[model samples]
Target: MNRTEAHFIAQDHLAREGLLLDRLDWDAWLDLYREDAVYWVPGWIDEDTLTTDVRRQVSLVWHTRRDELLDRVVRIRSRKSVTAMPLPRTTHSTSNVLVESAEPGRIVAAASFIVHEHHPRLRRNDVLFGRYEFEIVQEAGDAWRYARKKTILQNDLIPTLVDFYNI
Candidate 1:
């Protein structure tokens, strides 16, 4: 496929993923990622730098496998996780999707996102903004999945819990 076509595919995929997260459709949202996908949110090292190594440095969230994501979802669903208990309502908005590079079976894309979150228990509202770098891969039958997702959280001084749904 051409560059334009790849961009469209990436845009659509990202849009759908955001929609699912906003709807709290965990099952469908999980489907967007590959079984071996990497989900990482690097923490800031200093005022000017972010952590570069996942293993050595601190990270906000780092799940090397999709099953780890699934485990978190299970905790949230069962209300077993205190932080995720009474899961906050969230609306994820993704924009400025750009295809940085594309090959036959893979594409690298970047987009800006804002997640509006309302905590019912605390009666508070918060916003998280970030940029996402996604390594998307075309699977069999033209389906697309995220092979790696790196989220850069701009406002790192978080007030509440941060999870996959909210960032």
Candidate 2:
């Protein structure tokens, strides 16, 4: 495929992923990734740099594999988890998406995202706005997976209380 075609396909995949997240279909959203996927929410913009040591730096969220993500899902579903109790409904809005790079089976994309959470008990809305940088890979038979996802929060260093399952 030509460059334009490749870019379009990559963009479409990104859009679909965004829509799936917005719907909060956890299983369906997880199915979009490979078993070895990585989800990262870096604390800083330069965190993605090749030379940066992520362990030494602060990060918002980072999961190395699908099992880790599944574990998180399980915890969120568990009634014993106090932080996760009374889960807040959330909507993820993604826009200003740009395909930074694209090959036959790989795509690098960046977009701005806003996660709005509404909790009836709190009687207030929690908004988390950030930028998402993704490394997407196409697996066997037209399946797209998230090789890496880095979410850079606009308020990464701020001191604020957050619910356990808010993200």
Candidate 3:
């Protein structure tokens, strides 16, 4: 694919991902990831720094394997998670999308996202904004899937509790 086509494909993947999450289509969403994918949201290392070493410092959320991601979805879908059951509605807006690099079968992409969560029973509405850095690899037939996803939330403290899927 040409550079422009690569950009469009990468952006399209991101847009479809957000739509799947918003609709709570867990299985479809999970299919977007590779078996060894690592989804992480690291905590800030210091008061003044946005930098964090996820390996050395604590992380807000971390899922090391695609299995873990599926497990999380199973829990919520089966209503086993008290807080996550009856999933709240969400609208995820992704922008500033860039396909930073595209090789024969690998891509590095970045985007900014604002996710709004609303719950009718709890009377809650909250917004989370962050940057997403992704390492995506091509699967069979030139399809791309996430190998690693890092979410850097702007807030030092999360306004509300969150999980990988919600964030």
Task: List where candidate 1 sits over 4 angstroms from the true fold.
Answer: none
* Candidate 1 lDDT: 0.91
Tell me the TM-score of each prediction against the true structure.
0.96, 0.80, 0.92
| Collision count for each candidate, in order | 0, 0, 0
Candidate 3 clashing pairs, residues 3+ apart or interchain: none
The TM-score, computed over Cα atoms with residue i paired to residue i, of candidate 1 is 0.96
For 9-107, candidate 2 gives per-residue lDDT tens digits of 666766676566556566877777778987876555454442244788766667789788777767666766565456667676777777888878888
Q: Report residue 22 deviation for candidate 3 (angstroms).
A: 0.7
Query: lDDT tens string, model 1, 78-165?
Result: 8889877688888888899999999999999999999999999899999999899999998988789999999999995887787898
Number of the top candidate by lDDT?
1
Lowest summed lDDT across 10 adjacent residues in model 3 is found at 48-57
- Best TM-score among the predictions, by candidate number: 1
lDDT of 2: 0.68
lDDT of each: 0.91, 0.68, 0.84
Runs in model 2 lying further than 4 Å from the true structure: 1-15, 44-51, 156-167
